[model samples]
Target chain A: MKVMTLNFLTCAVKNCKSSNDSFPLHPKEAELAKDDIEINPQLLINVLPRIDWAALRTTSTELGFPTLPEQPPSPEDLQSDEALLKELHELLMETQMMEGKLVCGHCGHEYAVKNGVANFLLPSHLV
Target chain B: MLPTPDTSHVPYNRVYEPAEDSFLLLDTLSSPSETAFLSSRFCSTSPSSPSPPNFGAPLVLEVGPGSGVVIAFLTAHASTIFGTPHVLTTAIDVSPFACAATNLTVRKAVSEAEAEAEAENPSTSGQWTSAIQGDLVSPLRPGSVDVLVFNPPYVPTPGLPAPPPAPLQELRDKTTFEEDSHLLELTYAGGKDGMETTDRLIDALPGVLSERGVAYILLCAQNKPEDVKGRIRSMGTGTGEGEGWKAETVGTSGKQAGWEKLQIVRVWR
Candidate 1:
């Protein structure tokens, strides 16, 4: 899964839906891969507004990347700063979690990721 | 008409094949009226302008994108269909096989479209996220989805099969015929009135969708399309827009003796 996808995912457990910590499932033992995609600056800027900057910061730190700015850069700032744009593009678009476990903070459930696909199907007991 | 994404590589034994229902979705989404609606809702600027929209890119999620044909088509032709290339696409499915197949299908379609664009014009395809294995919309964050598409298990059957255990979700080196059949059954075989699965998806709409969210769901004659639309209209989007919800039949096909065999319903706030 692309690193950006983590921002939109939460714990599958229904009860965790209302919890603040359930989202941006933490990555553990994550095997990462970087694909050399041609950066599309406009696409990155388009996606910036929708991104949960705080969650992205947590994910990037968990995945061992350098710490991101405390606040997301404004669209105009991102547009003018080529280095910042490329950094965001690399983390959001190019980095892939090839293998790992996404742990929900609320339920402490570990959703396993193998071969780039994360399995979110809970066991019958949990479901 | 846009070229259908190549799903020839998808294994039909486990994944749902692109059928008339799938084709109807392609036709409906790309239709002039639907295109106008999508573009107006998603695009912030005129197409002639080169600047990105003021709003964030609309995230398009396809629930149960079996062979990924539908999502691939939407991703590959985002500009043509939604009037903007700045769209984000993803998929969720219960079957791991389907997830793997979708990833390949979307990638192939995007690359092929990119190649064609290089020779003809600038690329207009949207960005494809990843296809994850999950049940319905259970794994998604609430109020995050902007455009949702579903081609559900609308075939009425005695009962829905039990989903495979998590341990069994990984791809095995080989599978018995019975296992393959069971996996395929998950793609169809709605438990009761063919609405068993669709109903669950409908209930999630109000909670999963963003305020500007819209959904395109396919249903057959047996599913009682009129009643379904009525129920959707009555439901609240929680946006407090005071208009409640709106459901309309935007596309239909396989008409016989004044009876519509299958139709696509567009539901929105």
Candidate 2:
């Protein structure tokens, strides 16, 4: 999965919603790959408002990506600054969660990523 | 227009290359009207009409996008037809090689479209393409999908005999399942009249489809399309009489592959 979709993913366990760490699932020992995708600034700007910069920054840091500012860049800055747009593009589009696990902070559920696909199938009791 | 992304890049030895069934699915989705409808549906607060007459990019997710041809074609062209900034295109496959090939195919298609657009108008933007490896749509959130597409392993293979007793030899490390044996099994092994794998995906539709979402599924005549439709119509939120998901045989293709008759069915709420 791309880092972009990880932004929208939260722990989907039935009773796990009340937990604090439910919002941003933690990526542990994630092996990352970068595909050759062209950076589209306009598309990046379009999704900027919806992205949680802090969650992305934290996850990227854990996966050994370059540091992203805790605060998201302003819309004006995104349009004008090519460097910022390029950086965001690399983080969102190119980086792939190849292998490892995404641990749910709330319930401590481990979602394994083997061969770039995250297995989110919870056991029967959890569902 | 540039040629379609070369399927030769796909590791055919491990991945299932696009075939006649894939083309049948592609041919069925010729019109972009559903996407326009989806765009309107996204902006529509009321079921009748769009609120602000705006276009909201549709989220298109495909299950088992083996070669990623259909997803790439749709993603690269959605922007031009919808006149939207981006379309969230995702392809999920069980095989890791398929996922990698999908990412590569999407990237190549996008770059070609971008180059062409740039030559015409330098300010053109691109769309987003994501690939995930998983069983069906289990990883995706519930009721968020706009368009769900699937071309599952529909070939009915004979049930293999049970394994023989284990030999009394030294226990070696667990063998690599990725050594092409299991991969081939997944590509076309659909147990029990080819409905076993497809049925699992059907069970997931209600949870993954949005209130106004639609699904485009490739079905073999062997799976019994009527039964599948009836099953879906009586699923979650599809309970009441005349108040369930509607199924239509949007497209059909005649191809001789054992007892399978290829048909693309579009199911909508």
Candidate 3:
């Protein structure tokens, strides 16, 4: 899973309804891989408003790519700053979570990412 | 253009390759009138303009994008023709193989589109596509999806096979590629009236769609299109529901003489 996708995914437990820390599932024991895909700067700028800047920064730092600034660039700055856009692109698209555990902040449930696919399935009891 | 995968690859053998129903879905979405409607819906200006300002591209999710043909086709065209700022496309399927295949297919389509755009204008950017493994829309947020699409397993099965085992344990057991291929066969195993899965998504539509969101679902004769439309039109009120959903038969395909007819039902509130 790419960091951009992880940003939108929340814990899937049926009972975990509060939109609190359920999102930006903390990646534990993450193994990263460079996908070598071309970066799309305009796409990055478009999604900037929807992303949670703080959560992304925390996750990126944990994954050993601390490229995001403490404060997200303004929309205008994001478009104009080529370096910043490239960094965000590298973090969001190129870096892949090959193997890891995404632990939900609210329920403490772990969603495993194996072979580059994050299985967001919950147990029947939880469902 | 309706995207068709070069299915000579090994991984594609495990996926439910596109068929008549798939083409019908494509025809519905790409028809001149529908294309015009979508161009207007997704783009505020013509495609030649530079970075169409803040045209917040709608979030499009496709359920059971078996080979990702339809989603990728939509992404390629939607981004290219509308000059959309982004095509935030997501594809979901219960089978792991389907998810992988979808991601691959979408990546190829988006890359090709981006390459063409770059050749035309040296400074063009691109789009993003993600294929997820989940049942229905369970993993997605409610009332957030803007363009929901589903080409469900509408071919009726004898009965609903037991839902797959826990994902992690099942993943652990799928040590062989052949074992994984077996699951792909269930892509068309829709239980009872072939509406089992389709019906559930219809029931969930009111909660799944954004206020102005729209859904395009492919239904066949086996699914009882008329009755399904009635059910959708009466799915209660509030939130995603706005004066009840308006259903229209956007397009249909297959022999009129037989029961092979497929219809694309466009639902909006």
Candidate 4:
């Protein structure tokens, strides 16, 4: 799973939908792999508005990337700053979570990730 | 016509093979009218403009992308279909094999498209986020999805098979024939008029989709396409405001004596 995917994922448990802690499932024992993808500044800029910056910051820190700024950079800021654009690209596009467990903060349910695919199927009891 | 994504590598034993229904989706999405609708909804208003303010890239989610031919086609030919490459794609399936197969299918299509583009003018394909194993749209954040596609288990059957247990899903070794059969059943057997699964997905649409979200769902004759559209039209967009949902038949195939065998319904606010 790409780091960017975490921003749109939440605890599959029905009750967790309304919980604030469930927005960004925390990565634990994550194995990261970096792909040599050419950066596309336009894509990054366009995707910025849809991204939940606060959740991304949490995911970035959990994955051991350097702490991101308190606020997401503006589209204009990203367009002119090559280094910042590359950093965002590396975290969101190039970096892949090959193996790990995504633990939902509210229910503490651990969704296992093996071979880059995260299993979000809850057990019978949880479901 | 845009090239269809290659799904030759996908194992048909457990994954749903690309069939008439899948081909219909490809044809429908890339059709001129649907392309115009998608581009207008997702693409930047001014093509020449660099980056329009608040114009976020649309996220395309495919529920149960069995062999992944449909989603792969959308991702690979995004610029041609959606008129922009700034689109994000992902998939969710109950079967782990389908999820794995989807990842491979999307990657192969994107790379092939990239290679072809390299020889000519530069072209950018949409980004594929990831394929997660889950039931329907249960794992997605509410109001996050922009464009949702589903090729569901629309074939009427006696009863719906239960999804694979977590332990079974974890098995990495070769599956037994019975196990494979069961996995394949999850792709087509839709208990109770084939609306058992599609109904749940329809209910989730209001919650799973964004304000600008749209969905293209495939339904067969047995599923009562008009009634389904009526049900969708009556529901709210989950925003508690604006007009009720809208649904219309955008594509059809396998006509039999004036009866539409299978149809694709586009649902939106």
Candidate 5:
């Protein structure tokens, strides 16, 4: 409520310091895992091709979501039910990536996410 | 800032008899001239923006549709005039009570207007309005809508103080998002400078437009026409980018048209 009249279009990246501002309202990957996500180990297999799978395995294991399968659970292994669909809906579609941290593979920088928002702006030195 | 008519404590009187019911309200906007101008600038669009692929099928969207006034006017007129199912409104406002009021207003209006149309042709295909609880930046279906209409909270002052807790209290204040920089600067911060929220309200328009759909942003030119349009143009959607965006200052706002004295700055995509 105090002040700063900077135009966001003009200085949005610079104004990341404002508690009242968020450049984009999406949490990041690491921060989302901090929430109470009920882990379904089989999901690792299906989503592996789409994301950084190696990062998924490491991060999931580090976060104490059960270790992902050495080889993803097979299609036959996943056939017991549509559990993967339900689980993915919660993790991918429903969840907000607003406050999550994403570690850059390129820069090794950790972006701070706040208010359900993740800042992906890397320092100039990264480029 | 807008000089609004009776808020009638809609937020407070929301339980039993209804908060927005039984009142013919008029809001005195210091920015209506700007709003009307903005509305015209875009509504009277020129041919350069890509025309909708199929014009009649795309639904129209209205955000923060308080009291459902504009929708009522547009729908009632369209039902009588076009008889085309081109508009399907999604009135997004955070207040559940406001959503209810809008739903009721739309129902009553469409019922009456549709009835009149039936008397004439009896086969008019009129589309109804739907209200939903949402904020401005929330996701809109990527390609379903072709028109965007908005009459954001242009109140210069906090219209009323927060009512003591009760479901049916009256609304005296009109400020939203205490964290919004615009609400603070114009009123409590000292003088007539509370345009940040209104400006930010305009800033989030480019992405919401259909590939060829138009976004009609209503803003006041209490400051400068070019400055307000420049704010919108600066948003990555420059007038000469991949697809251009433009702003024009049309129509005047005045007490004669039951509007407060605000200049209307219109921006389009």
Candidate 6:
């Protein structure tokens, strides 16, 4: 029963290049789940308490998190939302995806994550 | 867990006394006792490394040093154990109180060592390591160290209502969750996601590590032990793998409620 919304409001909009760190995730990179990683269950469950349920639902979508039905989750929702929850789980949890590339939501930046390692550094002008 | 000079109960962002009771709270950590082993392991690597290229003059750097005690310990034994001719230690911290404490403690350690060295060599007492503010070094020089040690703020969740006074508060992060920004103190808290500071440390290490240089990091529950391994694995130098740089859990830091089961992890690179 966690809801999150994309809060691009707080990001450093000073420039588009603030989001390209790969190895150590840059603070500004859009938080989305990749193929080889899974969302942390504890972080997801814990965030259920601290985050805005409605906002979470909205932002996860914009951030490319899987979508679920609008009907309020029930006592059995944890079981029903299993598939979507896993998707949401990956969205909220901190993960180190070694393979694939991270696409930027703000800028058209694609950072590569290979061998469980991501190269986040961009060229000087991009920086 | 401790009171600042002002005795305010409000917590987070305050510098607490370094006594065993003040900061060693085990409320969030699984087992502080196990963590004590981590701290010991974090420290033990200094003696295990093959002598560095500069055995004649060992230059050591420490970051986020609280009271200079750890450096003092390393410098004291480095010569005999690490084959260092003379150790030049530099302890870095943002807190003036901590820096002063580090200066005094290092000097005291040097004097004590000099007292011992006087039995054989007279020059031992005069060479004391330098302590400066962290800002002094911007984007720390690349590959310039024999042993680099750091014990950052590794508190899991600094839920205390109010922050501590100046100097100490400067050491902690001023960011609130609303900001979604990071603070040095929050790095200690590790938040719901651990490795808050460890991530930054990892990003910085690539530039700081010397070829074949040794690094020691002290971590608590704020960091995920596995991630520490993961990042170390990513280093790709082949130094941290296969049981070489182990993050062993150390025992309690001698506190009251929390630290009895805290795990302090040490990373060597």
Cα-based lDDT at residue A13, candidate 1: 96
Arranged by DockQ with the best first, the candidates are 4, 1, 3, 2, 5, 6
Query: Which scores greater on lDDT, model 1 or model 6?
Result: 1
Give TM-scores of the second chain, every candidate.
0.94, 0.80, 0.85, 0.95, 0.62, 0.60
Q: Which portions of model 1 show Cα errors greater than 4 Å?
A: B47-53, B257-260
Against the native complex, each candidate's DockQ, computed on alpha carbons, is 0.86, 0.28, 0.43, 0.87, 0.03, 0.01
**Model 3 chain B lDDT-worst window of ten:** B167-176
- List, residue by residue over A15-94, the lDDT tens digit for candidate 2: 66556587578888888888777676756765675466788888777777778876888767988888878878888878
Sort all candidates by TM-score, best to worst: 4, 1, 3, 2, 5, 6
lDDT of 5: 0.40
lDDT of 5 by residue, B90-123 (tens): 4555444555556566656665655666766542
Q: For candidate 3, what is the TM-score? A: 0.85
**Which candidate number has the best TM-score?**
4
**Candidate 5, position B201, lDDT:** 54
Could you tell which candidate, 3 or 5, scores higher by DockQ? 3
Tens-digit lDDT string for candidate 1 (A26-116) = 9999999998988888788789989999999999889988888999998789989988888899999999999989999998999999999
Give TM per candidate. 0.96, 0.73, 0.85, 0.97, 0.46, 0.45
Give model 5's TM-score versus the native structure: 0.46
TM-score result, candidate 1: 0.96
What is the Å distance of residue B118 in model 5 from its true position?
1.3
Q: Estimate the overall C-alpha local distance difference test score of candidate 6.
A: 0.42
What's candidate 6's DockQ score?
0.01
For candidate 5, give the docking quality class from DockQ. Answer: incorrect
lDDT (10s digit) by residue, model 2, range B6-60: 6668766667888888887666664456546544555343446533432234567
Which lDDT tens digits does candidate 1 get at residues B128-197?
8899999999999999999999999999899998897654599776777888898899988888888999
